[model samples]
Structures are given as structure tokens and as C-alpha cells.
Target: MKRFQILFFTAFLFLCANLLFAQINAPSPIPDRVVLNLTENPATSVAITWRTDVSVSEGFCELQPAAEGPLKKEDSKTFKAKTTTIKYEYGDEPVIDANQHSFIFTDLIPGKKYIYRVGASDFWSEWFEYQTPSVENDKFSFIYFGDPQNDLKSQWSRVIRSAYRHAPDCGFMLYCGDLINRAGRDVEWHEWFHAGSFIYGMVPQVMTPGNHDYNDLMLDPHWNAQFTQPTNGPKGLEGTCFVIDYKNLRIISIDSAVDSELENENGYPMQAQKVWLDSVLQANTKKWVIVTTHLPFYSPKENRDNKHLRKHFQPILEKYKVDLVLSGHDHSYGRGRVSDNPQAGHKVMYVVSVSGPKMYEAGDKDWMEHSGADKQLYQLISIDGNELSYQSYTASGELFDEFILNK
Candidate 1:
């Protein structure tokens, strides 16, 4: 009996020792902050990005045609990911290094469903499915949000989640700017990632930078590391200011933050974007044009006006007959046209909205068709042929404003 008891005690200690060892040295293969971005050609390619701890130096993605049933791993094709080390610092926290991995899958069949997962042997992410935009689906809808700047983890989470729930079939999501409060704060960025969770990984994001997303008008280094956007913009503003053609629609992103810097010393950024905007508008062939930026050309708050933005961008919008100009920075909801008379031939509709907890009082303006104050809202836009439908909903899923623009 004594010998049997001794064996039992010995086995219990051995089990505990192994448990501790496993806890200390388990391989971390899981990826965090997984996101999808529209490549230059959405019909044939998709861009995916994710972050892992330093343990993961290199990773690959396996993709296959998605079906209704479980994913068939045997039929998967592997694509190697490009990895970059991101060294970030925030206040007093020790500077740390993380591996940012990106993979752009090309030659994909348009409008087809594909399942993909990332990682290395024995440590891989669960299969995620995404559908590419197809020319066959000529008519589609997309969700747009102005700014998710403050309290992203607590306040902004439900707004985006609600928008996704409301329009699950939308092709992609467009964020105007001010994704987070601080430019280079990793904690804030971590909250931004956690707020959207896996929704970002599924829906492609086309985001522009707000003043909060930059440090002294220069973009955050971490921005380029995590997001892989089209490099088709002007010479300097590659990721922040670019254009993407999704099906029959052309979406243009501008960095309006540069206009504010124009007053200081760096006026070249705005001038550079101006020249690029003219050339881009001149070459547009899509049926619809939507431009997005951080600053509102027409401010919505009392004693607040972006004079530089208005002087520089409004003319191009008018010249191109742009359908919509979505903007943020006022932290209020306001929509109006270039002219009070909607029947005017060269009018462009402008909208400034907010999707975070922050709120500002709506100021009166003659050009506004609809305005709301202290409301956190998200917009659902549907375009079918020449008719474009726009709807704004409050955070709790209440419709606050609706309009349709017929071309």
C-alpha cells in the first residue's frame, strides 16, 4: 500500500510539472488584427494583413474555393506572406517589436467565394471566407462611416457591428478618417482593432487618414505596416490618398489633413493632392464617383470652417460632378448640396458624419438639407444604376435621415 501511494504522488507531481511547462512554452500561432483591403484590382485580387508575436518571423496563407460545407484543406493553394517588423512605442511602455504579415492573392475569380487561413505548421488561424466583387454583380451596396475616433473599444464597437449586421452583403466598408484618437499610440490602435474584431478581416477596408491618424501631418509609420492599400495615388501620398474602382463605382480618397498643414509651412502636400485629383477626375470612366476625406469642406460647427479645404477641394468636386463627398472632423451629422437648389446641374452632395461617442452641436447652414446633433450615426448607401440611396442610422439602429440621389 505504501509503494502504491508513493507512485500516485510521483505521477501527480509529474503531471503538474508538464502542465507548467506547456503553459510557459506553448507555440503562439494565432494571428491578431487580421484585416482585408481592396487591392488595385478588386476583380482579380484581395489584400490581407495580420500581426503576430515576434515568435512568428514568416507565415503563409492557404486559400481554396469556398463551398457551403466544411473547407477542404487538401484543395488549398499556399501563398507566402511578406513580413515586416513593427517597432512601436507608446508613452512609458517598453518599446516592443511585432511582426506584421501581408499577402495579396491575385488571379482570383471575380465574385467567387474563397476561404483562407494564415500561419505555419501546427499553428494556423481558422478558415475565413471572403467573396470578391464581380462585374456580373453590377449593382451593389457599401457601408460608410465617418470617424471612429474616441473610445473605440467601448463606444465605437457596436456602431460598426450594427452596420455589419444591417448590411452583411455589402461589398466593402469605407472609413473617412480618424480611426483612433492618437496617431501612434499602440493601446488606442489595439482598441481600434478589438472594436471591429474579425469583421475587418472579412470586409475589405478603404480608409483615409485623419489628423488624429498622423503625427505633424506625416502618416503614422505603423499605418503602412498594417494596412496594404493601393499605391496608385500621387508620388508621395500612396496609402493615404488613392483611388479604387469597385465594379461600376470609382472611390477616391484624399488626405484633407494636409490642408490644415498648408496654413503652417507644408503647403506642398495639399498642392500635390490637388494636381493628382485633377488628373484622376479627368480620367474617370465609372458611372459613379465618391470622394472621402478627413476634413469637411463645409464645416458643420459654429465658428469652425476649413477654408483651405473648401478652396482647394470644392472646385474639383464641382468640376467632376462628384456624386458624394463623405467627410468627418466636425463630430456631427450634416448633409447638404453645393447649391440649395437640388436641380442645379453642377451640384455635389456633401455629408459630414460621426460614428463614435464624441458629439458636437449641429450648426445652421443654408445649404444643409438635413442635420442632426449629438447623434452617433452610420450610413448605408445603395447604388443601383443611376439611382443612389443613402440612409443614416443612430447607434441604437434608428433611422434618422434618408435621401436618394438620381443621376
Candidate 2:
């Protein structure tokens, strides 16, 4: 036992030294902004994405089950990564170019820890470890945030870090929308990535596109070029609108700006989404059904009422009896159901929140049970068998709000 402990300690130190050296001598071809994303079936599948300098055309990922002893390269399985060259000339700014690489690992053993790295064979990334979701109704937690869109590196970083400290073993992190202040801006994306460096590599991300994720010209081309999500959505809505099944929970991500964009420009239409959403809801077998989008169905102020989704999505969501409808874009916090009637059992809870430093004047409204403004917050949601608990926390780790739901 003593020998094993000494060997483990030595191996840990060796790994740390290698990581430090890699950071100090980071090269352009070295993978940066590496993130794990949710797949169709997270229990047996996971998607990874990373960026590199255009110098590297080919990319690779090596994976193996996490172990206590030495991590041997001989025991790892190698997979070729798909790389996309992204070049953009934003307005008058100099043209930006970068390579984005993505891969999906499937047939993973449920509930097992896996260590993996991404890069070329000659230059590999430091090992990252994450456990696959179990194939059961197991107790699990996940973090949810709204619009980490402004001052991401300085302000939004703390909210996410606080969420990690509250639930380090969370199955995933759900971003409601507006991940950055501008669409297709490299420097802003850099801030978003740099803020949550290692956390992105470890936990799988659930990203829903917000309005700012696009621009007046069209939806950001980089949206799909970056995150690798499910293609099981409607014909035109692939990665942007999809479903993920993890444990006994089913999550649906929808694009609410479609109604406007779909008519004028080529975009994911609400009608197509309605058909797909109805089908998905009908076939849902998970115990929990949560929907995330960039637009809220209800707004604290009258001017911001999301008629875009209210007329279409609100009815469908209520009909299907979804447990939670989570969204961003409001820049404030509000949580409640539509109706105030007590007899309206099996009501769907609606929540709109923000995690970035952007401030808005949130007024008290009749539809909201709890409302707040100008405060960045994150939510920790846990599901265990028949009980679901939600806790909202401030950037400083103070408990802002909480609630419990029983099945």
C-alpha cells in the first residue's frame, strides 16, 4: 500500500510538471478553448471541441479509462478529429483565422471515469478526466446560467467558479444564452473561454444560442462551427435546436428568434420547431423534461414580453407538462408559472435569469413569484429519484433563492 501511494504521488507530480511546461511553452498549434459538449445520449456518448492555430490541419484525440496507476499511452485508443478552418473579417477589423476541431466518442461505459487529450500525435494536450452519465435514474446535479454575455472574464467567471464550488460533480453546465456580448468576435470568445479554462474541458456543456449569438446579417456562422451538438433536430435546425438525454432527464434546446429570422433570412423556423418539439415531447421517457432557450416566454416589463415564443412555445410546453422552462435574454431574474390558480396542478415552472454583469431594471410583476435585477447569479439544480431541488446563488456564493419539487 505504501509503495502504491508513493508511486501515485510521483505520477501526480510528473503530470503537473508536464502541464506547467506545456502552459509556459504554449504554441499556436496547441489546442486552446477545449470544451466537452452534450451528445444525444450522454450516458454512452460525448462530444469534444477545440481550437488551434491554422498551422495544424489534422487533429487527434486519445482516450482511456481513468486509472490510479500510471497513465500509459499504449493503453489509449486514438481517434481522428474533424477540423474546420474558420476565417472572418469583422467590419474593418483584420481578418481572423483559426481552426476548430471536433469529435464524438461513443459506446462509453456508463458511470466510468475516462481520461482523454486532444492535439496532434506529436504534440498532445494534458490529460482531462470526466465520468460518463450512468444509465439509471441516479441523483445528479447541473449548473444553469443566463447570458454570460458581458465582462465574461472579470464578472461572469466568478459566477461559474462559484457554481463549481457548490456542485463540483455536476453532470453538466447549462448556458441559457448570450454567451458573449457580440457574435463572431474572436476577442470576446477568448474572454469567455479564458474565464472557464479547465472547467470547460471537464464538464459537458449544454449551450443554447441567444440573440447576441447572432447579428442582423444572420445567425453567427461560428455557432455551429464551434459546439458539436445533436443533429436530431428538425431539418434546418440541427445543432442549434436539439435534445439531450442524460440519466432520467431530457433537455431540449430551442431557438426562439426563428420566427423573425426564419421569414426574412434562412433560419430555423418556429413552425418546424413546433413539429419537432411535439414529436420529441410525445416520445419523451425521461422523468424530467427541461427546455432551454434564449428568449423568455414572459417578461417582467410589458415591453419585453416575448410574444415570439409565448403564442407558439408556451402552449406546446404547457400541453406537454414540461417540468421547467429555462431561458435568458431578459437580463433579469423571474420564476413562476403562467396561471395563479391553485387548482392548476402539474404546472410548468418558468425561469429567466442572468449571470453576466449587465444590469437591467427588473420591476415587480404579477407573473413573477421572485424577481431581482442587476445581480449576477447562477442556479444549481439537482434531481434525486422523486425529488428535485434548485438553489440560486450570487457571484459571491451567497444563496439568493431556492425551491424543492417532488414527484
Output the number of the lDDT-best candidate: 1
Residue lDDT tens for model 2, 300-371: 654777555665666677777789988888888989867433454556788989999997878778888888
How far in Å is the alpha carbon of 104 misplaced in model 1? Answer: 0.9
The TM-scores of all predictions, comma-separated, are 0.90, 0.89
**Candidate with best TM-score:** 1
Residue 299, candidate 2: how far off, in angstroms?
Answer: 0.9
Q: What digit string (tens of lDDT, one per residue) describes model 1 on residues 190-292?
A: 7888888888888999899888888866677778898999989877788889999988789999877754545643366777888899999999998899999
- Write down the worst ten-residue block by lDDT for model 1: 20-29
Off by over 4 Å in 1: 1-29, 259-261, 264-266, 339-345
- Model 1 lDDT on a 0 to 1 scale: 0.85
Please report the TM-score between candidate 1 and the true structure. Answer: 0.90
